[model samples]
Target chain A: EIADAAEALLGAGGVKVGGALRGRHVLVTSGPTHEPIDPVRYIANRSSGKQGHAIAAAAAAAGARVTLVSGPVNLPDPAGIAVHHVETARDMLAAVEAALPADAAVFAAAVADWRVAAEAGQKLKKDGNALAPLALTENPDILAGIARRAEGRPRLVVGFAAETQNVVAHAQAKLARKGCDWIVANDVSRDGGHQSGIPGGVMGADSNAVHLVSAAGVEHWPTASKAEIAQRLVARIAVALGPQESQS
Target chain B: EIADAAEALLGAGGVKVGGALRGRHVLVTSGPTHEPIDPVRYIANRSSGKQGHAIAAAAAAAGARVTLVSGPVNLPDPAGIAVHHVETARDMLAAVEAALPADAAVFAAAVADWRVAAEAGQKLKKDGNALAPLALTENPDILAGIARRAEGRPRLVVGFAAETQNVVAHAQAKLARKGCDWIVANDVSRDGGHQSGIPGGVMGADSNAVHLVSAAGVEHWPTASKAEIAQRLVARIAVALGPQESQS
Candidate 1:
């Protein structure tokens, strides 16, 4: 049933999948994590999951045995991929760790930076005194943890830096700090508002213009459909792995 | 294509929709609002939009002309409903206001309480210094705004109280403060962790146990699937509207 839906969506969208990463295991994370505030509410991010889902679908098309650890997204599961759906960031990390031994990994989900430090088990409500103050706590750095894995880490650990300003600089620092091999950065800034003549860039938008920042330097990729970007990125990963490494 | 997927999901789940609310213009809000921090990141609440979406579907099934003003969610658009998808709380409020003169309204979205006071046009990056500090500003109170509308207010204004403890007390206060006709309060507290003993109630779960609180009194409903809860709620709303008001 899931495959049928994927096939229909792909056919309707005219998406192409290839076999560049064939015989290799590739992992992808997509969407937004919901950090629980109470049973009813949580801290989350606005991640359309388009780019990451596109990447996962593209990777699968390229013949990699793909395991997509996805956050809550509305998209139909991509064809020929094993998908693990999780709600919270903690749950997402656990799922990722369980699906290791991959040739490459992509960190694409818009994970919340922080959660309520001390969560109230009961629903927090107004008492006419004043609005409640929320204490903050940082979430686990999933990309950093995977990149710095002591053993059994994927050969290529890719991270994403979603920025509005100084894209390359932040990507470089993130690449260094997260200890990831490559960083995919895109400009998400709005000069004024989205109504300021320019289109909505990166994040929730359909088309993306990205810059690839690596230890070697920066390479700019032209604006293209998310599917195109994924296919290209997967092909690049395939090249990095080489024939011997990618083959089962 | 969206309808096809939704049909498949509904068929698989065996969800039932009816026409108790025929001809009534019922507006519903669902999901979590994204408050922009930068272009890529946002401050959001943890709302899966399941309960609200279920309600929208239920109202539509019952023959109501439903308009769902939704935030970003992965769930498929409810079949046969007009869905206005927005990202931020302000946008959501605008959408809600535009759909005015509704016969009934359900404020179910877990709107973010605050937004970044100063939005940055550029992507915020760490500059070999301390982490950036976020200044918060309050978000528009959609429920209150609608409930307190000077004119063209929906006959039945419903709000939700997702509480952990003292459910009734908080909901009563919210009812008084928000000036809504009724409030649906639910206890989302898990006795232990999600894996401990009992399953996580409400939130992202398929089943929900809730309390319908109003000026009359508190009525506890037993645990049921989200669909079942929605259908029952819509039926109750129909009765409240009475015979002359509901029919087209």
Candidate 2:
């Protein structure tokens, strides 16, 4: 059913499955975390969870046990996946931690780096007086925390870098900083329009042009539908993990 | 078709239209204005635009020529209404100004009071250094700008106050401060849950318990579906504006 839905969404002939990740556990995070300033307002990123959700769907299609931790998104829960819906960065981190001990983990969520230091208990009133600057506090870095873990770490930890400039350089730096095995970098700038010519850039766009950066080298993948990108990435993950005993 | 869709969403037997507003012009603003932090990040309110859209649909059903200037919302354009889509408060204000000289205007949009003073051209990097406090500048008060206008003011200007505390008092103050004729106040606090046993608070919820605050007095309305509330409010608007030759 999940494969069928993915195929339908990504057009026909999408989501090829060979049971490459059979008997393996894969964890995925997607969408933008909302850092609340008050009851009604929050700071958010532009992630639509298309890539991450597609990745999860692909993993599931490959016969992997997939646990998807998602932030608030408009997309429906993909069939045949253990999905956990979360709101804030802290919540997302907790959810990710709870779903750990996977063969691979993908951090595609556009998590907010800073949240309002002091979230108001009530809705903040905008009186005639000049409004005060919202104090800032750093949120828990899920990718760094998980990747740097000494125990029960995923064999392959893939982080995403949605950059506006120096795409590969940023991804390389992010790979080192976050201690992740691979970084999927995508330029989300207005000028970085995908080959499909979809408007509004890659954050929420269907098609993506991504560079898979690892310790060995960077592989610049052509712009393709998010579902196709997911399939390719999952195939690479399967290759990196080698043939599992269950698959054999 | 507009009436049918509204009825379907609001459930069957909804949308009571008496054609009281026939030959009249009704302007409405809906949804939450997104203040950009950068290309990929933004500040947003939790408004679902359900109420405002319902009001617009109700007005259209009442045989009024309706203009809806809306911000970012996950809703289809209501049939039989001239819909103008916008993003930020500035854009919404501009759209509202362009759609002027109406018999009644409903300002239901949760416009951001402030925006980043200096929006970054690129995505702000989260280097190891301590982040700088975001500077915010006041946004143009759309309701006040139109309500207090010396020329071309809508005959009846209605402002909506989504408050967590002092709902009626805040609305009363807002009515005088903005020079709007009426204020529709809704308590959006976590504790101020609607009479309907539905889960989340009013911002994105289906049911609403609203207060109609005018110079005459306050009318506390029972918790009802947003569509029903819209119908009731439109009916009152038609009454307030008096009967027209077309209606007669």
Candidate 3:
């Protein structure tokens, strides 16, 4: 059935699939990681988990048993994919570890960089005059953590870079710092309006343009729907994973 | 009021006057360049126009009277900025050239790489089993064109690479091929899923993680809101464009 669908989509130039990632275990992280400021308030991004969810869907469509470690979002679980839901960045990390021993990992989740040093169980009353600064500490970079894991490190690890200016420069830095196989850099600024809403909203926009950077060099993909991008990406991954050789 | 708002946004840290780009005109191309397959079936992306739009906003925020050549996206025009909208890649190139006398240029628009060589006057009939293969040809690389221009070449030209494999290697190649100062690379594969839409379908998501790659080295930014990312990038660009003494 899948082959027939591929044939229909690709026409005469049907996708050549010998053994591309036939039985690969792929792990994906999506949505925004929450860092608790208090029981009620937390620091998080306006990520809707649309991109990550779509990727999970695409991966499953490509025949990979996918483990989706997703953040808090209202998206329905992609059909035929296993999903684990969490809130804070710490919880996400723990979940990734539990689903480890995978062939590859894609860190698409917007993990928070800082967490309140202390979570206040109860809301504190504000003094009338001045407020003291809340202390913050850096969260563990899940991509780096997975990349530097002592055992069972996935063969390929990818990270994301969202910048407004000098996007390439910043993305290069992240590739080195995260030690991941690839980094997706984009600029998200107010003029662009973040977290707008779905279908047309921030989390579920249909189309996207991005820069794909790695040790090899850069390749620019023109604007296309997320689903199309995912299909192309999955095909590329199959090739990179030695799909043809495995099939033969 | 705009100045005050900018000052407040800048807080204590701000771009220094008389920098590398002090007198340079910078033109940035952003958003998704549309290709009219038909009036209704045009090709685009989930680009929210966020990254490119943010780049334009940030450039203006950094004291550049940026002429933001944008594509069709439901975004409010940034204040204190000049904007031009175009539909196709060819139109985009024309706009970029019109915005000439630029000191730098950032080709951030996700221009469609291929377009239907000819557009059908009306929607073609869906005859059973007889599908028309849409003839496609490559669109000119706008970044490469600007970089290789014989006359009035922008001192600094940046191109974006959206690749799925061997990202760094590919970016390096683009840097040389596009003949630009820098190349922003990203992995828009299933693993990275940078093109996801927002929830309830309203706004574009607000966070991203990326790398800044260049000849110097790669710098990584942990996951953060796109707004924060933009601020940091603008700061970097200011430094890059600033006077040698200020950069030091």
**Best candidate according to DockQ:** 2
TM-score of each: 0.77, 0.92, 0.46
lDDT of 1 by residue, B1-248 (tens): 32233333344444533445667889999998878766555666666799999999988887889999999787999998999999889999999999998999999898877777876665544443214345566788999999998998999999987766677888898999999999988765665222233324455777777888888887787677888778767767776775535233
Tens-place lDDT per residue, model 2, A1-248, is 32233343344454555587898999999999999988888999988999999999998988789999999999999999999999999999999999988999999898999999988887887764338877788999999999999998999999999898999999999999999999999998888855343323876777889999999888888789899999888877777776777544
Residue-wise lDDT of candidate 3 within A1-248, one digit each (tens)? 33244434433533333235569888989987766544223445546677777777777777788999998776788988889999778899999999998887888887776566776643222223113344566677799999887788998887876554566777888898778888876544333324452112223466666677888877666566666655555555555565433544
Q: What's model 1's overall lDDT? A: 0.77
lDDT of 3 at A191: 31
Candidate 1, residue A37: how far the Cα is off, in Å: 3.9
- Report how far residue A29 has shifted in candidate 3, in Å: 0.3
Which residue pairs overlap in candidate 2's backbone? Answer: none
Candidate models: Cα lDDT each: 0.77, 0.86, 0.65
Better by TM-score, candidate 3 or 2: 2
DockQ (C-alpha based) per candidate is: 0.29, 0.56, 0.01
Fraction of native contacts (fnat) of each candidate: 0.42, 0.67, 0.00
The candidate, 1 or 2, that scores higher on TM-score is 2
Q: Can you write out model 1's per-residue Cα lDDT over A1-248, one digit (the tens) per residue?
A: 32343343344443533555668899999998877655544556657789999999888887888999888777899988899998778888999999998999999887776666765555544434214445556788899999999998999999987776677988899999999999988776664223243323555677778888899888887678888788768767776776634233
